[model samples]
Target: MEENAISGDDNTHWFHSNGIITSIDNSQKKICVDISQKNSFFDGTNITLNCNKSSLDITYLEAGQEITFYFFENNVLDTEVAIEKLNIVTP
Candidate 1:
């Protein structure tokens, strides 16, 4: 049996990485997540989240909070992905 292909904003690239919020650069519209794991999913990854009007709400976020980010790619645009959800599980 062939496995179903994940596509179109369905988060085919989903993976969990524990990290602390190193900094929040509102001016740059980016957040620096410092992953401590040597083989972390985001070891040196500087993810640039879409914080536009159409993007997910992030007003509740704060520095040093451990959050689980759910990423979903845009169906229409392959290069665009947005944070589908964020849950703060730790401080």
Candidate 2:
């Protein structure tokens, strides 16, 4: 199984991660997530997940909230990333 594979049978390279919503940019339809803590799926300290590219409703999201999301780079073009799922994490 690959580290970021969606599943053993799936060939797609999907990754799951949870982080605090450091900021929300409705104008750009992007949310800045802080993944600096240990256990993050990726190494970046912060990543801006594009809501426009995701299938989620960003209208209900707010700053300081924790959320878990799944994303994957386009198989055809690795540079093109998309968020497949997003959910608010409740404490």
Candidate 3:
């Protein structure tokens, strides 16, 4: 059984990282998550999660909160790299 993967436009990616909230851009509804710790995923970097793209209800997220989530690039005509969806796993 495969898990922790998000697919859009026939493209698939993994974002099964347990990260801590680093910052929140309420203006743009973007949340910066630091995946440097918790489960070993990626190169331990930070990724920005856009609320507009997320299906999960994270309107009450705060800095220092821990969560596991999946994220994927929007892949919009190569104009820019942005998040398509960021789903936070509910504990």
> Who wins the lDDT comparison?
2
Best-fitting candidate, measured by TM-score?
A: 2
Residue pairs in steric clash, candidate 1?
A: none
Residue 90 C-alpha lDDT in model 1: 86
Per residue, candidate 1 scores C-alpha lDDT tens digits across 33-84 of 5543433223253444444535655566678877655553332132222455
RMSD of each: 6.8, 4.3, 5.5
For model 2, what is the C-alpha lDDT against the true structure? 0.66
Worst 10 residues of 1 by lDDT: 72-81
Pairs that collide, model 2: none
Ranking of all predicted structures according to TM-score, beginning with the best and ending with the worst = 2, 3, 1
Deviation in Å, model 2, residue 79 alpha carbon? 11
Which digits, one per residue and each the tens of the lDDT, describe model 3 over residues 1-91? 1235554443566444466778887778777777645343343357666566545456777888876655453332121224544444433
**Native-to-model Cα distance after best TM-score fit, residue 35 in candidate 1, in Å:** 2.0
Q: Model 2 segments beyond 4 Å from truth? A: 1-4, 8-13, 36-41, 73-81
Clash pairs, model 3 backbone: none
Candidate 2 C-alpha lDDT tens digits along 18-91: 77888887887878887635442445557777767655678788888988877764421221234777888854
